[model samples]
Target: MTQAEGGLRARKKRETRAALAEAALRLALEKGPDNVTVEEIAEAADVSVRTFFNYFPHKEHAILGRNPEHIERALDRMREAPAEESPLTTMRFIVHDVLRDLEGEGELSRRGELIMASPHLLYQLMLSSFEDERQLTEALAERMGEPATSVRPALIVSASGAACRVAMERHKADPDRPIRELVDEGFQLLAEGIDPGFRVVPTKGHP
Candidate 1:
């Protein structure tokens, strides 16, 4: 095939893969995740179930999606971040690069809300997290050129994850809020410092 024709073919494949993922997420939202089956998603996307399996190993894989290359790209950006930059700064730069294109995350965010609302979907997403965490940690370690068990990567990933989780919570509560602004708010909150007062309380009867 000519280079132009090959490029077009690759683009078409990407489009088809994206359509299948969108179909699966949509069905999961409309009828809850558990109700959506692989065959149903394939049919919705105008593809055979075999085609769906070619793109995704399972129904859950469609929901979680996969882009190891993208993660690697993000890590590459992180690696080149200023030497003196803190983890938060570096991670924000990396994550913003990944998320700024929108990457259809708004749709994913909506689907996430639906997933959270249903116990079944929540369970499914939870299962996906185990691998998600492993891969993320591995990426961080690779970027830092440190061992996976090192405290530096661990601390940085933890803080970054907390920021992301906070932003997602706010988005779920009020999606009208710009996600970037919400994420900024989380980082600001962390900057201002968190304090919890502690006191010993006496039993009312004893007092």
Candidate 2:
């Protein structure tokens, strides 16, 4: 096939995938996600159930519309980060880059409401997040010239993940508040090291 043909096919697939996701979200909003089915979503998007499955493994995935591209870009950024940059700082920039486009209203607000209202969807998203964290952890470890199982890589990943979670929760609580601003605050707290005035005792096994 010609380059033009390949490009067109890729675009068409993206369009179909997006249509299915939009249909899934809209249906979930109108009739809870548990009530929506693959057939219904496909019909709404003018696609076949087989096509929907090709795009998403299940209905919940369709509703979540998790974009692979965003995570891929994030992983690339971490891998290419300068050697001198701290892992936390690298993560801050990566998060900002991934979420910057989502700063405004419209789809962002609708997704917040959808996920917050549905426990099932939230669980699915959580699972996806774990996978994303794992991939990012490996990339960060490679950049640090350390094993992925090392405590340092895991620590950075966990801490950065907490910051992202807090920012997300705050955004859900108030859609009017810019998500980027909240994310910045979370990263800033991480940068400062969450140290309370009082000293804390280390666990028996850990220093």
- List RMSD in Å for every model shown: 4.9, 2.6
lDDT of 1 at 9: 92
Q: How many clashing pairs per prediction, in order?
A: 0, 0
Q: Give per-model TM-scores.
A: 0.76, 0.88
TM-score of 1: 0.76
Please write out the lDDT profile of model 1 over residues 1-207, one tens digit for every residue: 999999999898878777887887888778877778998999999999888888888887676554444566766766677778766677777666656644554464765576557666567656655465566667667766788888777666666656766777778889898777877776666555544454668988886
- Predicted candidate 2 versus true structure: per-residue lDDT over 1-207, tens digit per residue: 999999999899877877888898899889988999999999999988988888899999989887787799999999889889889999988888766644431366677678878888889988998999999999988899898788888778878877876777898888777777887888888778777565778989999
Model 1, position 95: C-alpha lDDT score: 62
TM-score of 2: 0.88
User: Which candidate achieves the best TM-score against the true structure?
Assistant: 2
Query: Weakest 10 consecutive residues, lDDT, candidate 1?
Result: 189-198
Q: Summing lDDT over every window of 10 consecutive residues in candidate 2, give the lowest-scoring window.
A: 100-109
- The alpha-carbon lDDT assigned to residue 52 of candidate 2 equals 84
